[model samples]
Target chain A: MLIYDLFKMALRSLIANTMRTFLTALGMIIGVASVISMISIGEGARQQTLSTISKFGTNIITVKPGRKKTRHVSSDSVQTLLLSDADAIEEHVSLIIGAAAQVYRPAQLKFGNKNTNTTVRGTGRKYAKLANFTLDSGRYFTKEEIISARRVAVIGATVVKNLFPDINPIGQELKVDGNNYLVIGITEAKGALSWYDPDDQIFIPVTTAQKRLFGMSYVQSIDIQADKIEDLEQIKKEIDTFLRIRHGIREGEESDFHVQNSSQWLNSWGDAAKTFTYLLGGIAGISLLVGGIGIMNIMLVSITERTREIGIRIAIGAKKSEIMEQFLIESVLISFIGGGIGIMLGILISRTVSEIGGWETIVSTQSILLAFGFSVAVGIFFGFYPARKAANLNPIDALRYE
Target chain B: MGQLYLNLSSESVMIEVKELSKTYQLGKVDVHAMVDVTFRIDAGEFVAVMGPSGSGKSTLMNLLGCLDLPSSGSYFLEKFDIRSLSPNQLAEVRNKRIGFVFQNFNLLPRASALENVELPLLYGRIQNSHQIARDSLERVGLADRAMHRPNELSGGERQRVAIARAIVNNPAIVLADEPTGNLDTRTGDEIMNVFSSLNDEGATIILVTHERDVASRARRIIQMKDGRMHQDILNEGLIA
Candidate 1:
């Protein structure tokens, strides 16, 4: 039989029973919709994480003091990194742009009777630039302020809201650890992510924090900025070598400091997001499989119901292959139409999630194609047996089937 | 709509059977549906097969229609040996050479009378099938009811639609099994008349029926009894 005529016959039969056709296709619709929306949500989360991490600057590297090793026994963190180490890396490293040594401690701040406990970080003049911090209103502390050990501070958005509400925080006097300091700047808000809130801290001159507040000379950590992203690895190696020599750690021995870059964070988070996408897709794939089985079940019942019809076709000289082709076309048409509607439904679902649920969702072309292709494959896989059964029916027996 | 060929010459045999036999496995018992049945039918001859129920006339119809293979016998349609043809080749023979009408008027219930008639042509991969199917419906005097579904048609009209479907591809022979079995006497006579006129137009027709009145309409009669041919006679004398 001609393929066009076969398709017309199949379409006519399906149209003859519209309600059953829709019900049979419903399984594929739901399966493909869920797969698309799940993948979209996963991709959205990954993009959001990468963007947030990139906010810390991809070329920036952080070095924190690791546990001190004595006789191969690891102990508590030791303050091996100092101001000289930061300065030496900045001056001696070939690809280095600048470095900032930071000392952080929880301190109580009092502003005219109202008080709030906040973390106070003391660093050099280049700290704000290296950390991607922008001033909201006032200027950052100058180099002169850091060298002279002036009691100047930069307040964050959260601290301003808590202690300096109804008043301009810049140029105001804030008392830190019972010592008075002048607030010179207020940084813009950076939303809280995970366990840390960047907008809840205060920045002060490192000289003042070491000499007057903590009375300690060793710094807690160093943040280094490389000129270009491509130079990050080379810069890290240079810093590692310089820091180890400066701390006098012997060769082939564990360094007392740990070096980390933004790329590492990106790689780990990217891997996690990909795994999450696969997990959701796998679960949705099961639903698609079940949908295919549902199609097979319905097809079996349809063939049984149309046994006389099959007999009539066979009597009229229809080949067994033609009978098989007719039923197969019916099933494939159901799934193909279902997949199309499912793509639209899935896009709508993801859009609604992003709008109402306040979570990012990205619907990619690859996911839509994958879901559509899978649904069609399910149709064929499940449809084959029933079609073959119908084709193999004995014409005389089928004609006599009441 | 075109002139059908008159193969009235005795040398052009349309169907030939020699020692045709068929047995069915009914649990542990073997039932012989047809035993050593032999017959010959020429083209353009109207023949009626008459038998009581369980007399193996239905088995003969099946074998003649190329629907069922014989257990141990030889059957030929035209020049092709029926036993030697593959299932696909047999299907082609059935498509182009033989047409069938059933007792129950087994038209596809969902299709209109027009589509039903178009079925054989569709299977034969014939072009201009719609026009040809309409022409066949006109031949059965059902052209006005072409768009009506089977359920909407009366028993007589539905049988006419089945006849239209049978002749749509213009096959070499038309085999009908109890074509008027489900109709009232008046409607049955009407269906028989339609067959008589088609046979007059040089279309070969073979009918199976138990009714003597129906058998009288044919020019030849073959009677079966208990899986064997009891008698074969020319009904022209009775018509005279």
Candidate 2:
């Protein structure tokens, strides 16, 4: 028989039971929708994290005191770094832009009748440029101010809001730890990253923090900026060697400090995001598999119910292959229609999520094709056995079937 | 036209069977359904096969229809050996050369009369089947009911539709298995008259029935008993 006739016959039969067809197709619709929405959510989160990491400047590297061999070592607990070490690295390292020493501690600030407890970050003059911190008003501290151990502060937006709600923060006197300090600058708000809010801290000169406030000669960490992103690995190697020799750590002994770059953070976060995407897709894939099984189940039942029809066709002259083709086409048609609706619904769900949930969702062309192709394949794979069963039926027995 | 039916009978021999035997295994013991049954049918002959239940009439019909292969037999329709042909080739023979009418009408309940009659032509891969199906339905005096489904037709009308489907392909032989068994006496006579007219137009037909009056309508009668041929009679006086 011609394929056109077979297709028409299959269509007629499927239309005969419209409600059952739609119910069977519902499984496919839900499977594709969930997969698409879940994948979109994962992709959105990954891009957001990557953009935030890029904001830190990929060329920047952070050097913290003590290695990561032991977990949870705070900057105060380990002080193997010094301000001179930051100067030495800045002068000696090739492809290096500059370096800034940093030490932070929680302190109580009092301004007028308002008092707020906030973290105070003490760093060198070059810290603002190295950390991507921009001034909202006024200027950052000068090198002379750091050398003289001046009690100067650069307040963040959150600190300003808390301590100087009605007053201009720059040039204002703020008492920190019972000592008077001049607010020289107010940095731009840099939004929260996971747990820490960069806009909640205040910056001060490193010399004043070590000499007067903490009474400690050692620095906590150093921020190093490189001229180019590609030179980060080389600069990290140079700093490691220089710090190892400066700290008097011999060969085979673990280094006393840790050096991390923005790219490493970018890679780990990207990997984590990819894993989450696949995990969700895998779960949704199971539902799709179940949907395929449903198609098979329906096809089998349809065959049994139409046994007399099959026998009549066979008696008239339908080849076994032709009968098989008829049933197979019926199943494929069901899934094809279902998959089409699913793709549209999935894209709709993805758009809805982006609009309502405020997350980044990307519905890629590749994912759409994959889901569509998989649904068709599921139909074929699951439809085979039932079609074969129909074709192999004995005509005599089938004709006699009630 | 009359020439269409006349052209099919030009070759003379329609079906030839020699020592056709079929055996079935019911559990463990072998059951001989047909023991060396032999027969020959000529073109445009109206023959009746009459037998009681379990006398192997259905088995003989199945083998002749090419729906099943005989256990040991050499059967020929025109020139092609039915036993030597592959399953696909046998299906082609059935599609192009044979048509069947069953006791239950066996018309697809979902299809209209036109579509049901178009089935044989469709399987034969013939083009322009719509007009051909209409012409075939008109032959059975059912052109006006072409769009009526099987359920909408009376028993006699449904049987006429089956006859239309059988002759739509213009096959070399038509096989009717208890074609009028489910109808009332009046409806059964009406169906038999349709068959008689088709036979008069030079169409070869083989009818299987247990009713003696139904068998008397045929020009030739073959009676079966205990899987063996009991009698073969040429009823010249019975032909109208």
Candidate 3:
């Protein structure tokens, strides 16, 4: 028989039972839709993460103090880091662009009747440049303020909103730890970074916060920047050696601090996001498998129902290959129609999610094609056994079938 | 009476069977359905094979229709040796040159009269089947009911439609196995009239039945008993 005739016969058979055909195709529709939507959402999230990581300065490195175990716990333990270490690294590290020591502590800021708890970080003038901090109002604390340990402070956007929502916050007096300090600047509205809200902190000169608020002289950690992004590793090595020498740690003794580069954090976070996307997509893939099985079951039932018809066709001189082709065409048609509907539904669902939940979603042509191709393959793979059974039927027995 | 002799040189013989026998294997035992059957049918002849139930009349028809192979002996259809033909070749011969009408009027239940008539032609390599199918239905007096499916038609009407389907391709032979078996006497007579008219138009026909009234309609009757041919007789001037 001609291919056109086979297609027409298949189409007519499918249309003769509209409800059954529709129900059979429904599985493929849901399967393709879920697969497309999940993959698109994963792609969108991956792009978002990459863009967010790029916002941070690529050449930045951070050195944090590891927890120290002392022989005896005492209030007068010797400090492992100081302001001199920051100054020494700036002079000795040739690849270093700039460096600053930061001392961080949690404190409550009181302005009039309102009060808000926020982290206060004390650092030198170069800290703002190294960390990509931008001021939204007034100016950062001057170098003169750090040398004199003057009680000047710069608040983040969230601190400005909480403590001085109705009034201008710059140059306003706010009490911190029972000491009064003037807010010299407010940082720009930068969203969350590394799960920490950059908008909920206050910045002050390192010497002032150490002497007046925390009552300590040692800095907590040092932040560094490289002149070239490629020089970050060399710069980190220099800072590590300088810190170890300054803290008087000898060879074979573990250093009290560790240095980390921004790329390391970026890689770890990228890996985590990839795993999360795979896990989510894997869960969604189960639905597609179920859908494929449903298609197979329906096709098998169709073969059984049309057994006599198959017999008649065979008796009327239809070749086995022709019989197989007809059934295969019908199966593929069902899945193709289902895949088309699924693509439309997936697009609608993706748009709805983006609009309602404020989620980032990207629907690509590759995703649509991939989904359609997979459904077609599933149709053939799952439809094969039923088609073969129909083709191989005994004409005499089939014609005798009531 | 004239003695029938084998004509070795006659190319006009439509069917020739010699010492044909068939035994169906029913599990461990073989049931002999037909034994040493010899017959010949010419083109455009109207003949009937008559027998009681289990007398092997249907088995003979099946052999003549090329639906089953003989366990022994030779059968030739239109000069083609049927015993040597494959199953697919038999199906092709059935499609192109033979039409079958079953006792139950085995018209496809879901298809319209026109579609059912077009079925045999669909398998043939004919491109103008629609017009042929319509003409065949018209010949069977079913043109008005061409669009009606089998379930919507009466027994006689369904038989006429099956007749239309059988003849749509202009086959060499039309085989009716108790074509009016399920119809009332009057309806059965009507169906027989259609078959007689078709045979008059130069189509060979073979009717298989146990009913004397039905067998009397044919120009010649061949009787069978216990898987063997008992008699072959011609009617001189009988009105069926």
Candidate 4:
């Protein structure tokens, strides 16, 4: 028989048992949807992390005090890093444009009747150039302000929203750590870096934060910038070598501090995100496998139920391969339709997640095609056995079947 | 149409079988279904092979229909020796040269009468099947019931639709096994009349049944007893 005729015949049979057909296809629908949505979520998170890393400037390296792998990793216990180390790196490392050290501590702020707890980041004037933090209003604190330990602050967008909703945050006096400081500047919104909201921090002079607020402390982290993008790895190696010598760690002994470049941070994050994506996709893939098994089971039952019809077809001269093709086509049609519906459902779910759940999700065309192609392959792979069974039936026995 | 099945020496013969035997294993013991049965059917002959149940008549029908291969046999459809043909070739012969009408009609319950008739033509690679199916349905006196499924038609009408499907491919033979067994006396007689008319138009038909009355309608009767043929004769004395 012609392929067109075979397709029509298979369609007619599938339509005969509407409920069974629907239930069988539903398995595939759910399987593909979960897979698509899970993959989209993973892709969205990876892209968000990558963009954030880029936004912070890829050439920058962060130096944190102490060996982080040791039990004592908290900055309160690690006092090996200092402002002198930052100055030494800038003087010795020729590739470095700026090596800025910062004292970071979370503190409470009060403005009139309103109050909010946010991070206090204390850094030098070059932090603006090094960290790529652009200003929205007032200028960054100058060198004179750092030397005098002036109690002046730059507020981020989130701090402004929470502490001063209506009034201009810049030029306003805000109490930081129970000490009133003039808010001299407001920075543009940097959005979220994963779970950390970058716009929720208040920037202050490093000397003021160390002497007045977080007293008697070595800086928490050193933020360094390379003169050119190509000099990043070279700068990181120089800082590692210099820090090891300055901290007096011998050869083969672990250094007292870690010098981490931006891309390394991205790579670690990327690895974790990749694992998460695979885990989600794998769980969803199990359900899709179940769906293919469902198709196989239904195809077997359908073939057995339609034995007489097959017999009639065989009697009238349908070849064994033709009978096989018809049943296989029916299964493929089921999965193909299910795959289509799943794609639409996946897209809908992805959009709803980003809109309602506020979760990041991106459905790539590659992922859509993969899910669709997998469903098709599943149908064919599972559909073959039962169809072959149908094709192998003896016409006489089938005709005589009740 | 191009005399593809013809041989000048035996141009009149449509089917020839020799020393045909079939054995089935009923559990462990062998059951001889047919024993050295042999028959020849010329073109345009209306013949019936009559026997009681389990007397090997149905086995003969199955073998003749090419639905089952014999344990040992040389069966020929026109000039093509079926023993030499491949399984695919056998399917082709069944599609293009032979037709079947079952006792239960065996019409696909989901399809219309026209679709049922179009089935053999489809397998035969006949073009313009919709028109041809309609023509075949009209020939079976089912012109108005072309769109009706088998359940919508009466028993005799259903059998007539089966006959239309049987002849739709213009086969060399039409095999009907107990074609009127499911119908009433009147319906059965009507079905037999349709067969007689088809035979009058020079169509070869072989009807299998236990009923002497049904076999009486055929121009020739071949009787079977046990697993062997008892009689092969014309309706020379039975007519009128």
Candidate 5:
């Protein structure tokens, strides 16, 4: 009736049938191992996504002029956002640390015999650091050049690679829409993102583009740099209110401009990653459930096989609860052993995945403990019915069993 | 091992049963396995209950061993009424005051001879069970085979180990069912001799057997037939 004696008997019986014990525990091992590896892999992917998103300067907020509310019947709006609005945001919004007002147009570039169509963005000197872009060589145009509407441009690597294959692009003459502009600098090469490629565009003074090239008095977009990442929301709120009042957009109506923050983009992608993580955990949990059912199946068979032995034990003086405890301990021990082995295997797999497969995998102790605890619970939960059946067995009937 | 109060002037009863009956429901009809079985066993008495197959001898043994609940009975082990006791209390009675030996030896096959003997004492919550088991094994003349598993031992040795287990807790009654049914004549006689010696040592024993030869060794015999007691006689005359 003592727990120690019951455990000893259970251990001896399990040892008597080593093959069955190991086979029963195999299900739990695979179940727990998958749970661990799946969660760790999911966590690693989420962290990777966060770091990749962080690379684009999450603090930067963009404002695009919306033509949806335009009453123009010319098929296109004449001007919705002016450069004065950009100056107002820079001067009035205290949370706005810096602003880059830009106008964009796709232009055909000409240099010697090579010509290619590329995006030409007009912006001030502050656009480089605010947009997290760097100059590969040469220098940015002076502030005086933008004030004087000088014909200067900063070419991108894709433009330079296509337009000047044999010649250095900086300080060279490049014709933009039949207007000659001196290339002041060459921007760094940036790979493509989900939205667009920065390396395929050229930068010019906004004044020059607005007065001479596009012949427009309005800016296309304004990229606002927050004082800090956390201040973007406040800056956006202040800008929204300021823009709404300045544009005479009534309350409760859609504004003629849209303020976009990196937080929204990160949250969308974060939600998807979180859903994927939960799905992986759920699928892995199903295996654990299957493992638990396998344990119960084997435990039932074991109880049936040991009917005579149980009869003998009951005859010798073991109580019903003692019998139940004996079998429950056997199952719990099986799962605990399997869980221990599974933790090791899962850690090994995660390390292999990270080291060899080059996919980041974080093996957290919390995840291991959670999976281990779940396996234990599975064991106890599934072990109950078979154990109770064993306990409730009539000793006389069991003794006479063949 | 704690105390003893014996009245030499009067008889000390170990087990008392009256109006005991057991019925089994076999699908639709109720089969009466034991019908009004009534008997009394004295302390230190060696009694054999003999019956033909299907005569309810095993059922009677199971009831006497506290392994089954009778359908209607006022059975008593010492002062405690067996029918009134809870299952847990019945288990305690079996642990502290009764021991059982089965025809198949019923030793856990994977365990050693010593472990088999230690089982009853372990359930009895006896301290120093290993040493007690070792001493029990020695009493059965299997001291050298203490570490040997049941499969490694001969049939006679396994039965000897079972006897050691039965007496390890020093119970007032030891119930053995067909102790030598599977053995040859010589080995059966040897097993019967062990039982006789255990009786000589003042251990009350109730043995179930169909063999007249095995039954004759006991100091008393109770014969059963058709789920009823046919005869109850003392074999003290033959022993004398």
Candidate 6:
């Protein structure tokens, strides 16, 4: 028989029972829609994370003091990083743009009667450039202030809002640990960095903080900036070697400090996001397999129902290939129609989720095409057995079927 | 008796059967449906096989129509040996040469009268199927009811649609198995009248019936019993 005639027959048979056809197609529709929507959400989240990481300075590196162990079996080791180590790194590393040593402590800031407990950071002027900090008002302390150990401070926007609400905070006097200090600047409102709220802290000179509040000459960590991102590894090695020599570490012993680049942290985050998305897509793909099985079941029932019709066509001279082709075409048409509907529904679902859940969603053209092609493949793969069964039926016995 | 020719000439028989038998394996037992049945039917002969239930009349018709294979036989249809043809080749022979009319009319319920008549032509390699199907329906006096489905037509009208479908491909023979078994006596008579006109136009026809009046419509009657032929009689007088 001609292909057109077979197609016409298939279409007529499907149209004769519209409700059953629609119900069968609905399974595939839901399967494709869920897969597309979940993948879109995952892709959107991954892109957002990468963009956020890139916004931070890519050439920045941080060094922290490692836990010290006592050689003489003492319970505690008093080994601490100091300002001299920061000086050593600045003098020795060729690729280092600037370095700043920091000492952090919690203190209460009192301006007149209003007081708020906030974290205090003690560092030099170079700390502002290394950490990508910008001032919104006034200016940071000059080199003269650091050398003289002047009691000058730079407040964050959140600290100014809480302690000096309605008052100009620049050049105002604020008491810290019972000592009076003048606030010289206010930093810009920078949102959370690494889960720490950068907008709620105060900055002061490391020399003055160590002399007055901390009463120690030691620092907790050092921040460094590289002139070019490509020189970051060389700069870290130079700093490690300088620190090891300054602390008198032997060749075969582990160092008491660790150097970490921003790229390492970003890589960890990116890897976690990729795994999450793959897991989501894998779970959704199982539903697609189930949907394909549903299609196969319905097609088997259809073949059984039309056994006599198949016999009549075969008796009238239809070839086996022609019979197979007719059934294959019917299955493909069903899945194609279902896939088209699924794409429309998936887009709508993604939009709804983005609006309601406040999650970012991006639907790519490639994903839509991939989903449609997969649905077609599923139809052919799952529809093959039933089509073969229909094609191989004996005409004499089929005609005699009740 | 007519002279039977062995060569493929004008005088050769269109269908020749010799010692044809069919046995069905019913579970563990084998039932002989047609035992050593022999017959020859020439072109343009209106013949009937008459018998009671379980008398192998339908079995004989099935073998003649190429719908079933015989257990042991040498049956020649035209010039080809029926036993030697494959299933697909047999289907082709049935499509191009033989037309069948079943007792229940066997009209596809979902199709219109015109589409039903167009079915056999669709199976054939014929162009202009619509025109030929319309002409066949006109021949059966159902031109006005061409668009009505089987359920919408009366019993006499449905039987006429079946006749139209049977002759639509212009096959060499028309085989009817109890063509009027489900219809009333009057409708059955009307269907027989349609067969009479079709045979008058030189189409060979074979019918299976148990009624004496129905068998008398044919020019020859072969009576069967216990899977074997009992008598062969000629009707010297034709029914009007």
> Cα lDDT of all candidates, in order?
0.90, 0.89, 0.83, 0.89, 0.87, 0.83
TM-score of each: 0.92, 0.89, 0.83, 0.93, 0.87, 0.80
Show the lowest summed lDDT stretch of 10 residues, model 2 chain B. Answer: B1-10
Per-residue lDDT tens digits of candidate 6, residues A158-181? 898899889898878999988999
Docking class of 4: medium
Worst 10 residues of 2 chain A by lDDT: A68-77
Best by lDDT: 1
DockQ of 1: 0.73
**How does residue A171 of candidate 2 score in lDDT?**
87
- Which scores higher on TM-score, 3 or 6? 3
Candidate 1 lDDT score relative to the true structure: 0.90
Q: Chain A TM-score, candidate 2?
A: 0.87
> What CAPRI-style quality would you assign to candidate 5?
medium
Q: How much DockQ does model 6 earn?
A: 0.37
TM-score of 3: 0.83
What's the distance in Å from true for residue B70, model 6?
4.1
Cα lDDT tens digits, model 4, A248-327, are 77787677788888877778988898888888888989989999999999999998999999999899888888889999
Stretches of candidate 6 exceeding 4 Å from the true structure: A57-61, A70-246, B1-13, B17-19, B36-38, B60-70, B74-78, B81-97, B119-129, B200-202, B220-224, B228-236
Looking at model 2, residue A333 earns an lDDT score of 87
Per-residue error for A342 in candidate 3, Å, reads 3.4
Candidate achieving higher lDDT, 1 or 3: 1
Please give, for residues B86-199, the per-residue lDDT of candidate 6 as tens digits.
877877777778888878777777789998888777767578999999999999999999999999999889989988988888888898989988899999999999998999
Segments in model 5 whose C-alpha atoms lie over 4 Å from true places: A1-8, A70-79, A103-122, A132-142, A148-217, A228-234, A250-253, B1-11
Q: Write the per-residue lDDT of candidate 2 for residues B26-45, one digit (tens) a residue.
A: 99999999988888899999
* Tens-digit lDDT string for candidate 2 (A132-180): 8899998998889989999999999999999988889888999998899
